[model samples]
Target: MARVAGKVALITGGASGLGLATAKLMAAEGARIVITDIQKNKGPGAAKEIGGDTLFLEHDVTSEERWQQVVVETEKKFGKLNIVVNSAGIGTEGTIEDTSLADFRKMMAINVEGTFLGCKYGIEAMKKHSEPSSIVNISSVAGLVSGFQMCAYSASKGAVRLLSKSVALHCARAGYNIRCNSVHPAFISTPMVEAPLAAASDPEKARKRLLRMVPIGKIGEPNDIGYMILYLASEESKFVTGAEMVVDGGCTAM
Candidate 1:
């Protein structure tokens, strides 16, 4: 049977990378999806490609009003929402001395504040349904460990990790039957990783250096993380909440 069959999932950043991959995977497993991204052009094509009860709405996660609208539209169209994927985020690198306050705030606004809003609205929407629901926030191994130059990024992601845990505890105590968890992925070959890798003098050499961090000898595929998210979105994870599932090929283990 389809794991998420008949479930309604709203995924931000669904135009590409993990969000797009998750949308495709969940749709194939019979979930209704709302693919939201700032990329107006790519979002529609993604929705069309899914070829089912899928929607693509241009979303700005930084805006609380937009989050409100997205939730309202989702409930109106799908009647109820069962899954929320806070996959919209950005990557930046700079030491504490080199990082500007503006850059740090921008990173927090989207990565932390955006995810905060996503959780608030997602919880509100998911609680309306009796069936078990899930909210999966896409964090990073940076949240668990650290990068010398990723001070602000790590802080933002760390915020996401803890926020997910708090959401889970709240829902469990409130008897909402909702599950909230965080997925931490490291060095996944996605558009988010493309620019950083390309910035190296030799992209291939940079790729190899990154691979050394992953004990599994892989940089990870979007589908790998997608599959993990699927399990969390499904009934299989009904007993799972307040957990941090790492899909980083053991990067933090080292």
Candidate 2:
């Protein structure tokens, strides 16, 4: 049987990158997928490409009202909510001095605030049903260890790392049957990584720099994290909650 058979998954940032990758994988595993993104143009096409029990919604994750609406829509369309993946985030490159207060706040708004709202509303939606559910927040390896140029991004993701654990504990103690965890990936071959590389004066050199950080000697694929998400969203990870699942190709091992 499909791993997530009959499950309903709502993935943010699903228009592209790791979110799109996870949406595809879950759909293939028999999940009814709700793909949400701030990019209005790409989201519908992605849902169509997934080509199953899938939906696309225009979402701005930073809005509390929007988060509530998305959760309601997911439950209405799919009849229940079993999985919530907060895959939408932004990465800004700057040192502590280079990152302005506005930039730091913006990063926190989308990355931390967006994820907090997802967990808040996801818990509400999942509690409406009796099934065991999972919430996967896409964090970065920067969350575990700081990079000099990633001050704001690191701060945002570090918040997500602990926020997920808090949410997991809250739900578990309340007997909501909802599990919350975070997935940390390093240098995945997604648009997020590609954007920085594309902007470099020497794109190849920048690429090599990234490769040097990975002990595995290659950039990670989207499916690398996607499969870990699959396991978490499925019944297989029933015992797992409040955990930080790192899919970094040993980037943090060093």
Candidate 3:
């Protein structure tokens, strides 16, 4: 039951968290995987862990030059590019007034610009192949909702939401057979969420506070989001494009 068999996937931020979870799942499902991250130390190990036909490269998603190199490298190794998951991003907590201009710019650069480059270069690589292709951009529940302390993060993700739709529409109009979509997750148990909790005065209490927001009595796991990403990356979601898939545990419902 290889859902994504015969596909080649390049995942950003694959060193840990949701990206790592998705890499492992897709690899197990028989897709060749290319995992990239700024974490040069962990990226190679993660690729080795996924084992079969997996490659890891040190990457900075915000750099357009690096994006070109990665996509080229992916195709050079795998012969074709089929799926791309732009999961590399950062989260910063601050109010509009508290967040500095530099901080906001950095958020936009990584979360917004990085995804843009991934889509741009990923499409270039996939166009060479005549098969259907997919691009999954990892947004956040914050993209769909607002938080007092998530001004910069929310702005970046909100940009991702629309950027995905625009890419989808353009590709469809051009008959590229490439689908693009965004996935929004809430309170996933990843380093992105845990680091904030760990820094709190009481980590357990902070975790509970986040759980309360979910409306499901618990936070989410990385695989919770990874599964949705897999569906989008696989041919099962062939007709899906320009859609926002929310994996939140009823949080956005509230």
All models, RMSD in angstroms? 0.9, 0.8, 0.8
| Displacement of the residue 241 alpha carbon in candidate 3, Å | 0.3
Name the regions of candidate 2 deviating beyond 4 angstroms. Answer: none
Listed in order, each prediction's TM-score against the native is 0.98, 0.98, 0.98
Please provide, for model 2 over 1-254, each residue's C-alpha lDDT reduced to its tens digit, 9 standing for 90 to 100.
Answer: 99999889999999999999999999999999999999999988999998876899999999999988998888889899999999999987999998999999999999999999999989888998899899999998988999789899999999999999999999989998899999999989999999889999999999998899999999999999999999999999999999999999898999
* Best by the lDDT measure: 3
Off by over 4 Å in 3: none
lDDT of 3 by residue, 1-254 (tens): 79999999999999999999999999999899999999998988899888886999999998889899998899899999999999999998999999999999999999999999999999999899799899999999889998899999999999999999999999999989899999999888999888889999999988887888888888899999999999999999999999999999999998
> Which pairs, if any, clash in model 1?
none
User: Which 10 consecutive residues of model 2 have the lowest summed lDDT?
Assistant: 44-53
lDDT for each candidate structure? 0.93, 0.93, 0.94
